[model samples]
Target: MTHILLVDDEPHIIGLLERALRADGLEPVSAEDGESALQLLDERDIALVVLDVGLPGIDGFDVLRRIRAGGSTVPVIMLTARSGTADTVEALDAGASDYVPKPFVVAELLARIRSRLRESAGASTVLTYDGVTLDMLARRATVEGHDIDLSAREFALAEQFLRHPGEVLTRETLLKQVWELDFDPGSNVVDVYVRYLRGKVGASRIATVRGEGYRWEA
Candidate 1:
């Protein structure tokens, strides 16, 4: 009964994905362009989005920015023909929950989708460590009494740290838990987002492990 929004211009791609998603017991809602995709997001209770980067107007990046700016924390898995690392990093940096390059295997994509949905469904409503607080249901984070604006990725990373305070969360663990990535993507994305989180939640809260990873400290 989970509804997934599919945003892509190509009819064949949508058709293929639609069939696959239906077979997986998920409902598929299709949009051929970014505008429609945005509108659908506004009008429907979409659980997740499968967004294609090359839209006719208001490309995938822009659409993602808009989604975040609107304060929607719905999980988004971006699909793009560009297989470059730059694009992958850019999509992640832009707040995508996951990225899939074109010509992807259906099984892998389905696994990613299931992973994200499970993460979403299993989250606790609120987590507070020291003065930092995360409202998982609202997808909002606050430090002390002030609100902190966090992108989807930042919020997820913060959630992981708070859930296991004082635990040494290695980069690989973070990559898997926060980014739903099983292998290292050979990017400094984890470090980059950690810096971003520190800026908002105070630097002393997350300690660097020198050679290992990071730990949330009181």
Candidate 2:
């Protein structure tokens, strides 16, 4: 069975989600705080995570940062009650696979999780850009004979730039397409990920637009 890790403080919310997930044929394990959620990672083979932003003692953003740092590939769906676009964008920029606003339909959440799994399972092996090759299926990258191992985020970013080569992408555009967020002016999360990509893709492959965004130089 596909296991889902649900992290939320509200007992009612957790219960509702757990029952719904089980009804949809998914087994869900849950945690009520960031600390417990982080601990769950070590104990569960969770395929996906439903994370709440208002978590205590680490907050959703901090937990996400830690998750990324730990190199886990579990798809994440962030939950936030706020209607602020910035928060949504920030969640995406921080590496959430998707987001669910408070009061979201359980079916919609299930659909999102299924979609992500399909995409991940269907990921292509090789991605080439201006002679820089990223092999998603292989988990390797080669640029002019120099080969390197890429992390999950690196591969995702490389795919984005390769798909839209030379197109000047604002931080917002990159965040949304690559990270699945709406652009809200000043999130450094995108920039941080771009730097990670630069180190992998060779910094020269990406060009910065002063006072604007960036583009794959190709």
Best by lDDT: 1
Cα lDDT of model 2 by residue, 1-218, tens digit = 98889999999999998999899888989999998998998887888899999987889988987887676656789999888878976886677888889989888988998898787666555677688887653456788879877655667777888777888888877776776756767668778988988887678989999877888994
Candidate 1 lDDT by residue in tens digits, 96-138: 8889999899989999999989977886779998999998767
Model 2, residue 75: distance off in Å is 0.5
Give all candidates' CA lDDT scores: 0.90, 0.82
Q: Which sections of candidate 2 miss by over 4 Å?
A: 124-142, 145-155, 161-176, 179-218
TM values, all candidates: 0.85, 0.70
